[model samples]
Target: MEESIPTCTAFAGHKKIAAGPVVEVAGKVKRYQDKNPDAQILIFDDSSSQQVELDLRGTVADVLSRIPGNQDPDQEKSGPGRPRLGVVSREIGLLPRHWDWLALQPGGASVTLRKLVEEARKQNRSKDAMRQSQNAAYKFMSAMAGDLPHFEEATRAFFAKNRSLFETLTAGWPKDIRDHALKVGELAFHDDKSANP
Candidate 1:
């Protein structure tokens, strides 16, 4: 997936405390921690739903400055080649036949490889997006709602693409958890009309 500004959500116990850009979320979490020192706080990346740890010591600016990916763009180190174009060189292992085919293409190996990758990404965009959304939703659900009632059935329904059944099974869950799950999982059920028709 293409990199974007990191968005995240923070939960204090079962209630969502804050959400938005990572720095903003971290600031809110820090304030909440100041009020309720004993409260368990979990911050999750909105895109990946993976738990994140933040250094909450010191002032809000201090905390925000400590978060990863919060660096100033001007301070970013430029690598060799075209950094402005966002190109990075990486090694790939391809068989001789594949190399031969790439060599025969109009733009040589790198250009041909980039074109092929772009085509494949375009073709699989919907399916890829759906899978990513499902995975993110599952990660969040497993972390927050694992012990809740109908957890197993809800998971099954989620993966099975039975949106109605999934909603039904999660109806009794905490409002925050249910709402967030649906929000993150929304794209998982997106029907590609062109592909389906």
Candidate 2:
């Protein structure tokens, strides 16, 4: 399950139950749960390196289809007058000045708006990513480390990117939980830094 490329990793308690594609990861969870009915499993998305929850109650096919790469084939076929850039026509209400400003741009209003949106997304990508990662890690730590020592400080240190302090605070935690907290917290900090820097 360990690949050089990033992939989702799932753990049932301290044991890694699955790691790879969503389908493969889901399958592994199924198998693991089949043997250990009471085991708690947590999933982590590789890109954000944050915990992700999978509803294993669904069929394998259903789960696979939800993954990004497993989109339905029919959805790829373009209809007449429909651009293939996955753009959907939607009406946007803009003030007269806004419309005028957009019209002055080289491209039409739609193109200008699209460019603006893209630029904003690029500008906020790191902040948004870090926020998501931090939230995910915080959710996990809150659930698992509520009873552990220095929980609040650890959380603050987590957002502050004080990795050494975070590690020290979590040192008394269980090995598996401690390691995961550090991993996800570090990821959030790194993402935030990369975004802001």
What tens-digit string does per-residue lDDT give for candidate 1 at 1-197? 66678798899878999999988898899999999999999988887899988989998889988776577777777877566687887778999999999999998998998898999988887777777788999999999999999999999999888999999999999999999998888888666542210
The Cα error of candidate 2 at residue 161, in Å, is 2.5
lDDT of each residue in 38-115, candidate 2, tens digit only: 998878775565577666666666665666545776776565436455567767798999988888999788788889
Best by lDDT: 1
Candidate 1 stretches with Cα past 4 Å from truth are 1-4, 80-85, 104-106, 194-197
Clashing pairs in 2: none
User: For each candidate, what is the lDDT?
Assistant: 0.87, 0.73
